[model samples]
Target: MFAPIRWLILALQFATILPTPSVRTATERDIRCSVVWFPVIGMLLGVLLWVFQSFFVHHMPSLAASVVSLSIYTLATGALHLDGLMDTADAMGSRRPREAALEIMKDSRVGAMGVVVCLFAILGKWSAIASISPDHWEPFVVVPMMSRLGMIWSMVVAPSARSQGLGALFARKIPRWTVAVATCLCGAVCGLVLPFQQCLWVLLYAILTVTLFTGWMVHRFGGTTGDTYGALNEIMEWVGWYVFLCASA
Candidate 1:
């Protein structure tokens, strides 16, 4: 298999529940390079979602169709980012010292705060999907693509909170140039499907929101973690939907 193709496959394996050929000899460099493919995988997921929603909305209530689409979306990604959101919420909601909060984030147990935040995240996306005009399908693709792009940005700009874990590994090994490449890919996708002005607004919203959110995470956790990266992705998805909805409006 070609190296770039393998890297892309590794990325799909890591970020999604979608089945792919296993890379038994995947190197650390491969792992790092795979970050470049995150947005692509997101776009793929978005396409899946957009198609599913378009089909189901015709056969069922819009709300029910949205719920089913959202469920498929969650399952497709294995709810990996949602779990991150929950863990990060529990940690931040603990109001503990930075180190202790990090500890809370590491625990497998979900807390009350985690549940509340996760619920809100789901509801936010659901409402946005249900409320969106049936003619507006760009949000389905752009939102996922932009959110994953936001993850790449967060990983690049923020220091890792710990010396270990997936976040630190990515932060340490992912090439800085990967950010430019990923952003360009994301921009091209958005521009193809969205109005020029709306594309620009969506991109700006993603950059600004991710930047501000990263800063807050740094202040609270001293740096980004794997959990926080996931948290950012979820946050971007929720907010990205609304931004697109407004842009289209």
Candidate 2:
């Protein structure tokens, strides 16, 4: 029996630092099926972030609170996505041929471009969080949730750049219908927290951002990899925050 709960647990364990009950056995199918639960994990993360931001904003200065909250956010995910972003940046920055660039990405050392982009991403998130009005809790929840949904979209639609690695397995194994299921679930949650029109717009932007980014990656690397998926998540999160900010304004 392929229990949905078990898949959800797999997703949580794969995507976050949060502890979960161990699943004694897991198959490639189980890992692939877990993609459906990614948005749910993002929603949970958003809830935690919203709650943390609400608490910290009252006790500390907005800038300081933003730093602390961002730190917690990064720590919670074990900086998994950020690591991907850096590796992707390093690969792209090399501007080498496709194979060489991928080699660069696989390298363990962080390059200069990687460090710079990482700093920018963190600073951008911090500034955006600090700027968001404490009364507006929607961005916190919507951004993270939508970003994870973006990952599913990328994995489902984009071919893997290589024959091996987690990205290839997910790309090869994920069911197409999972896209609709994940999108609807994410949409329903967004609708609950955001105005209908705004939710629709945010979803629209998410689709555009993910599609365009995936296309760009394909153009560069012949397809996407695990690093690209992480890179997309980080990029989409920033885009989501900005979209929400503009929508609220």
Candidate 3:
């Protein structure tokens, strides 16, 4: 059900743009495609990075290069996931009931715990990209794609932890087919950019890890909330780096 693949990108951006409002505007059928469009966004961002890397990471020393690259790549999204990661971390710190955790997540206040997790996740991505051999641009182009897929994984496996929330609408409307298609599309992109062995390994590890992690969250939370989904995306991508570390072109 690649219905309106073109609109998939629009729907994805729409979720970020109109957010909760989009659910009211679009039919339920459009919901899953919204999540599916994430990798496409990542792919577009990756292409931009691929195009500009020489002007940034290539010319700079490794540490400086990583910082420059992360800034360019993440600033495009205004560090959206980073914000989610931070909020999720703060929420996790609540150590209370689900309602309390979500309340903390929604608070505008940024706590030290949130900042620490955000900083570490950001630095981890930078370090992974920095340590990667300069000749391998595949990881550069593909990791973002995989990272977005991680978001979808959270949406797919976990039920909404709460009723009448963002995660609930997403979980209610998103289709299983969209997940399958997104996975295949992601596989195709990775195949184009990576050798068979490397692509297979990274994908296998990513899929297994995401699946297991999503399952754990589902069991623990009895479903997923918006914050948990955000947390899942950040965690999965950080793990993706270590998984890919074993693979090569």
Candidate 4:
């Protein structure tokens, strides 16, 4: 229990831009152990976004408030997942051999596809937020948590694309029990934090969306990578928001 507590802190450190003491000697195994807390970090992010929206929505136009909320979300995650989404887009758009696609993803320079997808992701999110009433902000809290759960699901269902790196570490290490616990945590948290039907709606769609994404990724790359995990999070986030908007309506 104590060890997992430490791992949870480590997970928070890796997953967010929140201030955390540097873990200079943390091992790969430690990083793998942190998988259990991935959704926990997402939950925290959701809470923060909800609080931000709550504080600002009453003061500004919904679109403006939505943009501000999205900006805060970007900063909090250090744009890490967005970067992955772009890179994955570039790779997928290249439609080259797996090795070549991987190489494109490794490139630091953003390509046209990367730029377009990044724009789509941010703009789509902005529009989704704008579409909903500010009073219905519970979806903001639920979506991030569901998206992070998508990441964990991808890790469990797919093998690593590369021989080494964070993807490999997570692929080789996430325990089945950890995935189970994370799933249960997600359900419990959603049930408590959101309307019951909306909660189920989010979870069901999140899982199915991720399942389709995982299948496509596996077919394309023969496995998953860190970038795809991030991509999954981004895609699932949009899905969650859209689902919430529809369900709440």
Candidate structures ordered by TM-score, highest first: 1, 2, 4, 3
CA deviation > 4 Å runs, candidate 3: 1-6, 12-25
Better of 1 and 4 by lDDT: 1
lDDT of 1 by residue, 1-249 (tens): 798899999999989988899887988888888889999899889888888888899999988998999899899999999999999999999999999999999999999999999999999999888888667777877889899999998888888888899778876458877888999898888788888888778978897889899999999988898899899999999888888777657
Residue range 43-145, candidate 3, lDDT tens digits: 7776665556645656778778777766777777666677777887887666767677777877778899999998899888777767776576677667768
User: Which stretches of candidate 1 lie above 4 Å from their native place?
Assistant: none
- Overall lDDT per candidate, in order of appearance: 0.88, 0.88, 0.71, 0.85
Deviation from native of the Cα of residue 58 in model 3, angstroms: 3.8
Descending-lDDT candidate ranking: 1, 2, 4, 3
Q: Candidate 4 lDDT, tens digit per residue, 1-249? A: 367877887987877878876665777777777888988888788777777776777899878887888799789999999999999999999999999998898788899999999999999999997787757667776788888888988898888888987688887468888889989998888888787777768868987999899999889988889999999999999888888878767
Cand. 1 Cα-lDDT: 0.88
Give the alpha carbon lDDT tens digit for every residue of 1-249 in model 2.
457888998998989999999999998888888899888888888878877888899999999998888899889999999999999999999999999999999888999999999999998888888889778887887889889999998888888999999778987569877778999888888778878899788978998999899999999998999999999999999888878778778
What is the number of backbone collisions in each predicted candidate, taken in the order shown?
Answer: 0, 0, 1, 0
Give the least accurate 10-residue stretch of model 1, judged by summed lDDT.
170-179
Candidate 2: segments with Cα more than 4 A from true spot: none
Candidate 2: residue pairs that collide: none
Predicted structure 2, TM vs. truth: 0.97
Alpha-carbon error at 105 in model 1, in Å?
0.2
